[model samples]
Target: MKPEFENIPLIKNEEKKRFEIQYNGHFAFIDCKEMSRQIALIHTEAEPELSGTGAAAAVVEKTLMYIENSGKKLLPFCPYVFAFIKKHPEWKRIVDEKFEGYNQL
Candidate 1:
């Protein structure tokens, strides 16, 4: 059976520099760094059990929505986030063009 991702709450844990979600007894998160009016999405991860269940995508989608609604630009430094935006061009509106090819380690 597929894991349910609906109705999950994404939490912006600024103290930890990551947005987090609790699911099935595990925690999934996306690391980020906020600077001025831009936010750099640096990394994303989910528990092994959450992998392949669309949890990562959900987190990224919600994070992007938050960024858009907050009127901040996105610097997708995380490969997953960059790829996600590439696949979903609608999100390009919030992406910082200057950082289009930025994938730092």
Candidate 2:
């Protein structure tokens, strides 16, 4: 059966260098580093209880949207983020080309 993910809010906590969300009363986050022209998605994690609930996907999707709207490129340092971009080629438009091996990463 498919699991329904709640519409949890995401926070771009620049000071903490991460995008955050609260899920199942626990904190989930995507670690990141923002540079002058790009943002590097370094890691992603969700509370164990929130696993398989779509919290990670939700955070990544919203983070990608935010990066697109901000007109900045993406540096998917996180394997999960890279995989997400590979699956959604449309998002590749915002990715930096120099990271030539993005798919291999």
Candidate 3:
């Protein structure tokens, strides 16, 4: 069976080394490095203060989407990212084969 994936809008910011997907002014960021990929769930202090809304999940989703769409591999060094991949088996194909041990993290 396939799991349901929610539709979220992701904002790409290549200059910041991240691709941000925002919702209700809160966002998740995927930091891309030349060597590896990292995901972070972050919130800002603005009109709507979103301090820890599990935005990281969206980041993970966006990263996986980007990897799949671009034929790139993901090396998730972030613990949150590692867990996201572990929980979502459907996204495993985008994960780097070298990251097989990510389940342990």
lDDT of 1 at 30: 96
In the range 15-102, model 3's lDDT, one tens digit per residue, is 8767666667555566666443533323211123434555656556766776778766777666667667678777767766666474
lDDT of each: 0.84, 0.82, 0.58
Report residue 19 deviation for candidate 1 (angstroms): 0.5
Q: Over the full model, what C-alpha lDDT does candidate 2 score relative to the true structure?
A: 0.82
RMSD of candidate 2 to the true fold?
Answer: 2.7
Off by over 4 Å in 2: 1-7, 103-105
Estimate the lDDT of model 1. Answer: 0.84
Clashing pairs in 3: none
Q: What digit string (tens of lDDT, one per residue) describes model 1 on residues 1-105?
A: 124765888899979999988888887889999988999999999999887777888888889988998999999988998888878887888888677473321
Clashes of each: 0, 0, 0
User: What's the residue-level lDDT of 95 in candidate 3?
Assistant: 67
TM-score of each: 0.88, 0.86, 0.66
lDDT of 3 at 68: 77
- After superposing candidate 3, which stretches have Cα over 4 Å from the reference? 1-8, 35-48, 51-54, 100-105
Candidate 1 residue 57 Cα shift, in angstroms, is 0.5
Q: Please give the distance, in angstroms, between residue 79's alpha carbon in candidate 1 and its true position after superposition.
A: 0.3
